[model samples]
Target: MSTDLQWLLLRKYNSYMVKGLPEGPIFSKEPGNLVNIHSHKYSGLSNSKTIDVSDENGVIQITTRKTASPHTIASTRSTSNIRARSGGRRALRVASAPAKQGYRPDLRRATLARVSALLAAQKEPKAQPAKKPRGKKTKASA
Candidate 1:
């Protein structure tokens, strides 16, 4: 079967399931061979799975499975480290609390009052005590 026809069949049947293209050329002169490729995104891990596509009796079959190679493990570990460093999970959890409680008019009023107070303080100058003359004060003419 032509690669174009294979691609069309794959698209028609498995477009939602499989996103990225086959690792190498699809069909590549062989009609009944398995082509493996990594997807662009899967389970929050990028390029983490090896997808197998085979033409079985003109039916395009796609299978996606995770590979247990040293590189894949190391990449997963680095991804976890990045997430920890970014504090994404913590920020999401912390932000969700306020959203769940809904808007609190009391809190909003209090925050606005504090902010306006700060702004007013910044706009108004503080009164400075009068300074005495700095010139040397010798004994005044007797």
Candidate 2:
């Protein structure tokens, strides 16, 4: 069976099933929470922008802005050759491609929320079984 649902957490730490991409905020009932959504980029270039969303009583607010970097705008544009462009796209197929035309922050937030919830739900399993007694020593009594 497939583990790491939505790559939220490793199967060892995850137990419950969370939606791969929930239709609404993961914690729709909870209010005033924000999620960050960024484009998927491979290679030297990083995501150019981000979309942040806040939820208040199921009301979702969105904000989008370019990433702040010390580099000038002239240096930030895509300078990679066509082959490089194709290669980067080929990589990280699971990741969403950079929002070409536009990005819907609300939808992105919904998607991110699902992953976030799953990750948050992930809990560490206790190595020692409290209900059971301590294990015998490694060397068996002769």
Per TM-score, the best of the predicted structures is: 2
Each model's TM-score?
A: 0.18, 0.21
Candidate 1 C-alpha lDDT tens digits along 1-142: 4434545455334423444466642222122112222222111122323222232332323333333666675443211111223343442333233224452222333223322333343343779997755545433422
> All candidates' lDDT scores?
0.32, 0.32
Candidate 1 Cα outliers beyond 4 Å, as residue runs: 1-102, 124-129, 132-142
lDDT of 2: 0.32
How does residue 65 of candidate 2 score in lDDT?
Answer: 41
Off by over 4 Å in 2: 1-47, 67-100, 103-142
Candidate whose lDDT is highest = 1
RMSD of each: 24.8, 18.9
Give the Cα error of residue 58 in candidate 2, in Å.
4.3
